[model samples]
Target chain A: MYFTSFEQFINMNGHGFYVWLSYACFALLVVTNIWVAQQRHRRLRKQIKSRLGRSAKV
Target chain B: MSWFDNWHLPKWFYQMASPKWFYDFGARLQPWFAGLALILISWGLVWGLLYAPADYQQGNSFRIIYVHVPAAILGQSLFLFMAVAGAIGLIWKIKVAFMVARSATLVGASFTALALITGAVWGKPTWGTYWVWDARLTSTLILLFLYTGVMALNQAIPDRSVAGRATAILAIIGSINIPIIKYSVDWWNTLHQPSTFTLTSKPSMPPEMYIPLLLMVIGCYCFCAWLIMQRTRNEILDQERQSSWVARYLED
Candidate 1:
């Protein structure tokens, strides 16, 4: 709302590229971190289930 | 009952050390923190990027602070926290402490990397260069390496308990860098600017700018809390795979 128009907001007084790039990278970092954590959790659950199955036979 | 029984740290304190309790707590809290993080970060971004007034000197590029400052602060704080958790693990022999320390290292490193990258991006516009060997920047880089060292040590050791102890020691020793990173701007002349937010003084920026920055910082912290809890829960599961509780939990 500080900017009078949408074009000015996008350009950000010509600093838009740098500002937007940093935000984009930040988004990537957040997404990748969550994805990795979820993957680890799912993988661990599978591994534990498999181990439990094996142990049940003994 | 003896006074000692009542005086002992709350019953939950001991329960907190149990991997099962921690796993359940983390699982329950992760989504809540993640949700808070999402809402706060989005609010900060919208206000910071669009509504905040441009800096007189740096122009709009200063907006990067919403992400950069929070990431940098989180990175440094996470390292300090890892060291404290490591110390607790060492003193109390709490496996949960060790697991939390392990989970924090990589996430801390990622935040550090984000800080460095964003700092560089901001620098090119403000400082007219993308990189500098200034003390603050250099010290922060070293902080990243220390995080890597802790993670590498954890992976290289085959024995979990031994690895935990060694990593904890490494984290404690490497913590010496944290103070260096924090004081580098004050102790030595550097191209990197002095910290904007401090405990003793009002922020130089107006409320419009500072408020969004504060939101971003809190959001980053919540995100970090969620991420660490998730990873720590996974670590607990992996480490306790042989335990009867894990077996029963897995069965369901």
Candidate 2:
């Protein structure tokens, strides 16, 4: 096994800081991308709706 | 008869060019891909974090590979995928392809950013430096910029068709860098390690260590696929609102 105990595994021989930091950054990035993708979708939806609304009124 | 066929990409591309067809296809594919992605990720993370032996030299720090390598590979490949979609849309004038390209570029750029940042973090400890101008590193830097350039070009053109063509040109030209990025470490001696994923010869790490890396790579890819579908559906809806069917579909 890679580690003797759960605690040591979590500790990662004190390299946990780096390991976890890397993970944290990766998670943040993925989350942010998802958020941005959603935002883009919403923005495009609004734009399309507004365009349609204008055309409909005319 | 078998469900799948030999000419997979063409058939897939044809189906993808129709928004309604793409939407149905995405719906079918998304859940399966997402489930497989989640399963593989869970399996890989558990094995990598707890089962695989720490690197002899790097120790536990090497665990970052489960994330970094896949992010990097997908980061690069997704751009190529977007460019191809853009080209198809531009040449064939398929609105769905352009929409897919637009949605995908954003996701690809995001992944590329993640890869570069994660790499920098890993580099700090292993290389005793956070960033450097090594050939491999430099090429990847260029890749990030290329992704940015394509994105900006797509947005700058006022007309959507012109936007697609402009970005397609940039994407095609930028593709030259993918090969350069792939070969940078090999072509030049550098601080960055040589290829982690390979086809032949003995793997640098043991099976336990590499397996999770493999799973994470697969998961990253699946996640990309899922994200693209999710985002492209939104794009299609946005672009196709003028179609009478959109109202009926959205009503549900």
Return the top candidate by lDDT. Answer: 1
- Evaluate residue B144 in candidate 2 and report its C-alpha lDDT on the 0 to 100 scale: 87
DockQ, candidate 1, vs. native dimer:
0.85
Tell me how far the alpha carbon of residue B60 in candidate 2 is from the true structure, in angstroms, after superposition.
0.7
Error of 1 at A1 (Å): 0.9
Across B137-246, the per-residue lDDT of candidate 1 in tens digits comes to 66668888888889889999999989988999988888875676558645654335454322113348899989999999999999999999999998998888888898
Candidate 2 structure quality by residue, lDDT tens digits, A1-58:
7687889987998788778888888788768877876787678667766766677689
Cα distance off (Å), candidate 1, residue B216 = 0.5
- Residue B193 accuracy (lDDT) in model 1: 49
For model 1 the TM-score comes to: 0.90
Candidate 1 residue-wise lDDT, A1-58, digit = tens:
8999998988998999999999999999999999999998899998888877787789
True contacts kept of each: 0.90, 0.64
> What tens digits encode model 2's per-residue C-alpha lDDT throughout B30-92?
899889888987888888888888887778888888887787788789888988887777666
Clashing residue pairs, candidate 2? none
Each candidate's DockQ score against the native complex? 0.85, 0.53
